[model samples]
Target: MSYVSRNKFESARKHIQEESGNLDVLGPENRSWWRQKSKNKQFNQSNSSMTVETVKQLTKVFCDDEALINKKLPKELILRIFSYLDVVSLCRCAQVSKAWNVLALDGSNWQRIDLFDFQKDVEGPIIENISRRCGGFLRQLSLRGCQSIADGSMKTLAALCPNVEDLNLNGCKKITDSTCQALAKHCVKIQKLNLDSCAAITDLSLKALSDGCPQLTHINISWCGNVTENGVEALARGCPKLKSFISKGCRQITSKAVVCLARFCEGLEVVNLLGCNNLRDEAVQVLAEKCNKLHYLCLSGCSQLTDTSLISLAQQCPYLSTLEVAGCSQFTDAGFQALARSCRYLEKMDLDECVLITDATLIHLAMGCPRIEYLTLSHCELITDEGIRHLSMSPCAAENLTVLELDNCPLITDASLEHLTSCHNLQRVELYDCQLITRVGIRRLRSHLTNIKVHAYFAPVTPPPSAGGSRQRYCRCCIIL
Candidate 1:
């Protein structure tokens, strides 16, 4: 307190030196300017100020315990070292001395903090304390999975940490629209926000964010079922600079929302509408038409999406690299043919359960997208040895293809494996439920690509039920050949 005046500092030094052998901390080089710093304290150190006598009294207890090398360092150097410590360690260091308390709690040392590891221990009181201490110096704060945080905690945080740009409150179940309203009211610098699984937040929260945080580039409201078109439209119009919008499992989101977003946020680069089953071809078409820079798009489980969506993306979004259309069974080889001709940068494609695709799809991709690496065709029952032959012979398969999944493609046989033996870059292949795939075929493929892992499964034929008896059935066989 009060810069630990020379007289008291010396007295404490003598008192401490009798019990322990040193008064060398707070080195002499810092003595001259230390007095003038009494008037130059950072932010308001009202709560942290302590009387010189208080520090002197504590020195007796602390000196006998252990010396802290950090305490011997200059305040500037001490704070620089504290910057790398996590939140818990900082709290403990603050208890060592009044000088150390000031160094440990310096706002600059609390710029970015992730409290997910201490979720159960984090609560409203602790958050408010951090908000007061961190203030404008805090740029990012992640309170994800800290479910016990109270409804008012985030409101307090938004008010105090006004300059925070990245805030993640995912799975903080108790927070509602009020928290977002507070954020909209105060935190204008917010750029990336994740409110995923914050179930109580509805259209009101989105509207609040839209009206205020115009700089937002990334927003995720996944599983927030109550969000719909009205909220998204406002968000799109207000934050035209937005680049990523993830609303997976938001069942209420439909074509109206996607169209509104696509129309306004033309700069969007990544859009995930996964499991939003109400989304249709028109919405995806609009998105592909507007967001030409689109790199990753996931429409998995949007069953209403047909070939029109894929064709639209192929014709417009030439930058497309990753696309997931799992469970959208309407997609056929015609859509993929167009995709291959346009999106040459395509790398990962997931067509799980898109059963209408056959050998033609693989041929189109193999001949066009030389960068294709991960291709999933689970349940694409029409894929046969002919498709594998075309794929294995392609430069993409030889140079870039890493993983290929053909599970439940019953038409694929040992011949398909034989065709794939030449894909030297291949890493793993899945053949579960491919009833005609034999172990010998896998061995042959692995002989060429020695490090490749072939995941295969086989089921024994079910014998006739034993008369008047129930017996344990043989376990299914799963092997990585």
Candidate 2:
């Protein structure tokens, strides 16, 4: 009686009485219960007269009242059913009825809320309400790109949902170390954290995380300039389970922190140190030697890295599938050949602007890595049609190759297009600024491979050399170089 609300009871009774011949089917016990309800009073006294009507009423109480039966299902089962619905669907469900409203907004259903799509609509008060409603049940929450959230909202979340494990505040620039401190003091169960482009963060925030969130596994502190080697070293020492660390553009991170990470976090699989200009071959060598599980590495713009680091990776890191050494001009064919010989599982390779790689590197990759799918050789001046021909004839080109980018390889000509025709698996091809490739070549290539997307922009036509244009030609040459 107490489990079913008054409104629900009245609604069920009205429906049953209307369907079952105007309460004629209702037993005396139900009749008396209805009479008490209709009189706007509670019936504490019981009538113990055994009759057929009384038996029917008891049967109805145990088996009928469809609404009550539905509501009587286990709350845990209901919560499990609601878990598949997203936040927007849950909001729509809350408008169904009073009972549904309560069930829809239950903290258990709102545990993992992702407001990334609705970031603009989520203000501080909205976050506060959600935090209050969810309380300790909230585990994973993403407020990524929600720039409206400030320190107070984060503090409220820290106070209310301290059990939260995965929190993504990426691009929330207003948050500072204070928010991190609050989260550290309260959310001890914190695990995966993404603070990408959060400019206000510093080593203080990382220190707090080191002290509190020892359970931290994955963290992205990219573009946080104030975070130095000290913070990274602290995390390396504290969080042993840390696997993936992305700190692109964090200029303060150097060999010291990277070496510490390699020593402590041997299970690290993905490490992106893009634009960490201070990192050199020594740190990378240590990483390749210790972190055998490393699968993805991005050292783009780490200019200090020499062929020694690549050689170390070639010898040690066999599981590497994706590598980005875009601006590493110091990388040569010697290092690349070693890498191609060892890392046979290489799927994506970005050697953009590694100007020294020539036919040797391409031959090594084409013959070794048949699983190679995506390859970017932009600005590699040394690559010619011969290297491309070798790659096009390789097993990778016939079956697995999908995306091929050759943005500024000036030595490539119409002959490369002829070779690419054999690559049936080619899906997207970029040939911007290849001076000798004409529209006719691309047209022929497209006709041969109808499924492939060929992107070949013609270079600006230069007029016949005149006295006044000789300097212009020199300048154009300079630009291409």
Candidate 3:
């Protein structure tokens, strides 16, 4: 160990000796062994706490002392810190004092600005101030959830953040195709962009993005109702490096878009099409064939998809780990069986509202996907005590399993809760809307699984009769663990 590590080890040993409390039990040999062990552990944790303490001290010294606060901070450090601070915090810091205001408003420090929830009426002032403060150093900008950000505001931002790489205008209700045109003209280096939930954006905006941001890797246009397969095809043609794409709730996109993505963007790892109600088994087949590197896939609310798509996914994508087919009501026992058999390395699976699934599927899942850690079966009406019992008795039951959600599964009872007590590593369990689960079951779980977080929503408990025979005493409990 170096000198610094050795000193840290000595300090840790002293701390352990002071805190051990049973000094009388330490024999010469035992004491020597513990001292050596403590030294090793302390060396591993060397200077981490000290570094944190130093940063805290520096922040306090800089923020408190008037003389130092007036002195200009290193331009590089100011820009670095400003990039991390959100727009609200940046604006607040500018009001600290005259010197800080100047530093905060400096052109070099305004690299990435996030005006997410800035005032609606002050859009003009906000844009003017930002443009004046950040001459050309602005690179990344996000105006997510900003209701006041119109086409003009977007144009100003695009003009200012010239070298912009990432742009997010998610839920910017006022922005239209014109905004995209301005962005294409100004921000040529845009890579990761999110126009999610922007209803006004159409194929025109997508065309601009494809034409301008050729190096784009990640794009999220989820809930943009006007974007269709044409837009997606255009994107696939222009941006070959696109890896992560989320078009969830985009009902206009069809299997054609999926095929285009598979044929063009071979490097995709994350794709979320949740609530794309039009997608069918053919889309999944295309994805499985082309996007073999995919790790995360969300087909939630794709009601048209059946077991065929899931079976194809399991057979084709060997690296598949996280799968969310929530609200895919057509999935049956056969789908789960195929998933269990082929996708053995599955880590997280959400089968919420898959009513056809039962104990047999759960048993197969437990036996096959031994590495499964997170499972959600919310609203799975077919899931009963048998399924819960089988899951609780699986090899993954004792350990590894950390999160489990069984909300609205009425068949789950106190017995299932008792079975879960053996899962010592279980961190979070949601039993919301499981009417059969009572306080007794919760108390029993707490007894064995001391560290586990448990959530139980009780709605069936009867109210006690009032003494005055006027009103009944109601008791509702929602425990979050």
Candidate 4:
């Protein structure tokens, strides 16, 4: 839409011709533009009557857009611009023009892609197309929840994207051990792998990855029921540089697998063993003792674990910031007291259904842990208003406290909410099933902490009166009940 002054029209045309290297298009050889006829006859009569000053108006300049762009901007700069676009936008850009298609489909523009949003649309054909286009330049790819992608498509991806380092195939149910074998053989640079909820993944898959992908640092096999201690042990023995091993709901995990991880993977930082029901106190203790640098640990649903497991973690894993021991009924106030005294940097903990914990556990946490940000004591019925009083006035409650859940703790009353009003930073509080928590108390709390969210339910104060034509119902208030 740019134009040149009539005086400089010839100069502009010459400049564009030289810069774009198409002299025959706009140079002196092209007399067609001057001889062009006006479709309206009145325009010619107006031009005859116009003065020289009027004829000095701007001249419209036209040039080949793709050629001008190719000459103006560097190819690397164009590719760099395309790199910021997501998969869908990049595909749309491919349809714009020929030059744009070449730039959008360049392998260098697609290093990392997450197709989780289009899980249903992403089938084997779509994966094959992406694999061929992004070949070798693809580094991180997540086809998580794309259940239609089977072993064949995955094999093609592995063969094409040999340098892919991080791959997430979580919830891809159609892929089996053959997909793992293909990836292990071709994509040797893979460091992080997530096979969560891929129920077909078995020992053969783990064995294949162990044999070829030695640089693996993080692996999540959560809900992979076919994976057992044998597979875990094989993976642990091969990947000595492992940092995080998340295998939640892999119930076949036993002492042998835990010991193997402790003995080989010293760099283990995050270990999420949720629902690994068979893990005993001794195995967890060994892991805690060896992997002292553990940052996040989830022992939820490990019903066999006792205070011994907590004590071992308290003594060894000082860096433990997140601990989820929900449903571990054997963990008591004594174990938590030990943990509170040692793990002062504790930020988030989920102790749901640990019914044995009493007011003393909160007292110990309030006195010891100053960095506590999130705490869930749901279904821990023994905790009372006094426990909340200690928590609300603690150092953590000053600014660090954001979320607190005391659901189903029947002993917590309005006094608990009154105490929590002092926690100005508290963002969310859950009080479901605490019958003593009245709506008046919640309103008063909101009056102080204007942004706080209190999740609770309260029944009506009284049932509605029966309707009759001869009667009128009235509610009792301050003077009557």
Which regions of candidate 4 deviate over 4 angstroms? 1-67, 460-481
Models ranked on lDDT: 2, 4, 1, 3
State every prediction's TM-score relative to the real structure: 0.81, 0.81, 0.76, 0.85
| Model 1 residue 176 distance off true place after TM-score fit, in angstroms | 0.7
Score candidate 2 by lDDT.
0.88
Better of 2 and 3 by lDDT: 2
* lDDT tens digits, residue span 414-464, model 2: 999999999888899999888989899998999999988887776566876
Model 3 lowest lDDT segment of ten: 472-481
> Top model by TM-score, which number?
4
Computed on alpha carbons, the lDDT of every model, listed in order, comes to 0.87, 0.88, 0.80, 0.87
Clashes of each: 0, 0, 0, 0
Give each prediction's root-mean-square deviation over alpha carbons: 10.7, 11.0, 13.3, 7.9
- Model 3 residue runs over 4 Å out of place are 1-102, 117-122, 460-481
Question: How would you encode candidate 3's per-residue C-alpha lDDT over 1-481 as one tens digit per residue?
Answer: 1234556645654664566452322345445754665556544564533345334433443354343423334646655676677667777878865656776677776677776656344465577567767757777777777777789767887787778788887877888899888878888888888988789999988888788878889999988999999999998998899999999899998988998988899899999999888888988998998888888999999999999998888788878889999999999988788878887778899999998888888999878888889999999878888887888888777667899999999898998888888787899999998988999889999889898888987765585666676542453443322
Per-residue accuracy of model 1 over 337-360 as CA lDDT, tens digit each: 999999999999999999899899
Q: Candidate 3 has which clashing residue pairs, if any?
A: none
Return the candidate ranking by TM-score, descending.
Answer: 4, 2, 1, 3
